[model samples]
Target: MSAPTEVPHKGLITASLMLATIMQVLDTTIANVALPAMRADLGASSDTINWVLTSYIVAAAIATPLTGWFSERYGRKEVFIASIIGFVAASMLCGIAWSLETMVLFRLAQGVFGAAIVPLSQTFLLDINPREKHGQAMAIWGAGIMVGPIIGPTLGGYLTDTINWRWVFYINVPLGAVALLGCAAYLPHMARRIRRFDFIGFAALAIGVGALQLMLDRGGEVDWFNAAEIWIELGIALSGFWVFVIWILGTEHPFLEPGMFKDRNFVTGLVFIFVIGIILLSSLALLPPMLSGIFQYPIITTGVVMAPRGMGTMITMIAAGKLLRVVDARKLVVTGLLLTAWSLYIMTGFGPQMDSTLIVVSGFVQGLGLGLVFVPLSTVAFATLDPQYRGDATALFSLVRNIGSSIGISIVTLLLTRNTQINHTELVANISLLDPEFAARMSGQLGGLMQSLTLTRGEGAFWSVINQSVNAQAAMISYVDDFKAMMWVTLCAIPLALFLRKPTARPAD
Candidate 1:
């Protein structure tokens, strides 16, 4: 059957696409908390269990660039339907996985299929809706995108705790089934064109992305750059990326069209999305461990505290949707960067002794700021670009965002660990028996408390406790430093906001 020129059953199609989008995005983080349980049951070591996450990330990163080409080769509906089926089947296989190897393989398959869902969903939403409603549509779509990551850990923890770790994978079955049916019923067909596949370009891009993802994922584990594997991966990543760029520059039908980059707004949008991605997922990566490990909060409690952040995002995203029509998009982005930076600045002041209110409030504010930035950014980014380029552009947009997040998380986590060690050494160096500060502190409340516990100053137990306390304090200070660093990063984006041009209103919308 030929594709309809106009969107049919728009509501059903929108809901279906949203479900598919949420299902795919949710998998990115939902399996993290469940990893330990999977490891224990499968008799896998710590090193091997991580492959479950790495496999998916690398596979998805490698496959995502292919989405635009695939959509052009096959119809959108066909690719989306096949993707849903493949993803659902893969999810089932993951749930039934009896070994670590099987689990990793299934996860890879899931990643490959799941990668298309996001770009396709974005393209579909934009295609079906009128130009004027694009902002509202994107706000809805962005909500699913943003909320999925926010709630992933909480949902995964609940599923793993209440039932079993397998349920996290299994939960996708019903949801995917509904989405599949909806797509089959409501999604329209698109005209397919036969374009010559750029194997060389694709290969180079895939190798680069795959190697980069591996380097990032394994860097923290293997001590980065020190390990031969990391160096090799880094070399491969750099070489492959440049090779692809060079090939695209010279080739007539390169994988990525040069025309897309010609648009100043799209180019600026790329930089903005990259920064947003870093801010979005990196903060998320830091918070859970800080809450659970440092603050001694339970998983559920951590989730509860983080929930308000998502609520703030949802509220502002809806508002930003309406604001886009009236306000200069550049202003919204500036306001967002400042708000996000302010939130991170507040987080830098956090101490282990503080209550959860600070976290909740700051998180909500940051979310509001991010929500404000994301909607307008998406709206203006695509406003001047040709509609034919939407699929490829969205794929690249998602790719850049994902890469930024991966890099951001890796850098922050490494810094946190390294800074903690540095801080630990500095703090420990001062606590010598000859130091007067140590002596006076030992004579104060800390000393009095230790004395009441019947622990003598020079005893092994007393020294051990002192060392432990120093280490804990050092780690807290390191976390604060990381937050401060992120704040600066957010603030740095403010000036770039000036580069973004306001989107001119269209009569068609």
Candidate 2:
């Protein structure tokens, strides 16, 4: 039961949809850097401050199941417009909140409504246009979604450093207003049969997804398996996810049809999307802290360095969109993964002596990899899915990507934390056992003995200085080793791609 496609002003529809998606995507990362300033202003703890991010993600995950249902029950145009208005108002509230709790609550409201814009925008764009050109629609829309994070932190860093963090929220107002107005005026009312809302499915999905994100995000921070709250959350997540699957399987009408997951190509496309999601976001998330904290880069400088990745993506997306009509998508993905692996290799080569030139090169290469793979993957996905099923597929794709990012960040953060401790420990142990020759030489330099700066003993503190030097080098080794581990993980995509289907010269029409 493929939905009949509509004729459209391909260029204009593409513009409006991509603009909406860009605004929403930007909101996801822009507030992240502002969290520190938020902490200072609200006098909150670091652990508590992370709720600004976790709440937003959890809200989106909980509310995402409604996106396709709403689009079908109402009109895509109506839902899209309402989403823009809701997101804008929430952004205003976020900027003006007087307390940490208020700001977090407002962000939840923002995420709940804001969750639909990205997938729906893409869904709408592809639906209105000729099926063969959906890849072009994806190209236009992906430029916004894929490039948002790259731009967000730099923009956030600049705003926080130069003016105020409130500007991050304030910045969303104009962009969102324009998008809302444009959508209201220009978005088409494509005629299609709508379905009844699935109340039971919605409840199960909310319980399952909300509990899952809550547990994953808070569990590690709270010391997993030790807290009573976490175990309860675990129970909710398993029950909800498993039960939702069973319920959706039996329902005559579901929020998401159980049949959508049966498409081999759709399943393959999802795996690739998740892999790319993890690679792109985890890298962006790690870069700001690594550059500013470890490498002594300023906020603005770190943000600026990461900007090349966005630039590369923008360039490659348009180029790859045109190529999808000619190239095999799986081959493009394979090539893109190798390029991504190579780009990560470039990143791996960086050490304590890294400079702007190296950062720029690595970011640009990685961006190229993203752009090359993303467009092709997107084009092929819709090519195989009929219009009737596009909404279902789109929602699932978005969910996988979001989950991938959560998993990616959590894994990287934990790895860095543990490795830092191990590296520091080994460093301490080796320093204590100082080489026989080096110990003698160090002792001689310090005038023949160990001292704790007690002048009464007539001794100098020499061995401590040597130990300090040893500790510093060990710390550097640890950071570098952790970085190498991340680079290796980037290669994980290659094996995953082996299962992808062949890409043809044109999208299905």
Candidate 1, 287-400: lDDT as tens digits: 998898888887799899999999989998999888887778888888888888989988988987889989999999999988888888887788877777777899999899
Cα distance off (Å), candidate 2, residue 378 = 1.4
Across 3-78, the per-residue lDDT of candidate 2 in tens digits comes to 3565445566666677778878888888888888999997889999999888898999888878887777777778
Error of 2 at 481 (Å): 4.1
Q: How many angstroms is residue 447 displaced in model 1 relative to the true structure, after the best TM-score fit?
A: 3.9
- Residue pairs in clash, model 1: none
Candidate 1 local lDDT, residue 209 = 98
For each predicted model, how many residue pairs clash, with residues at least 3 apart or on different chains? 0, 0
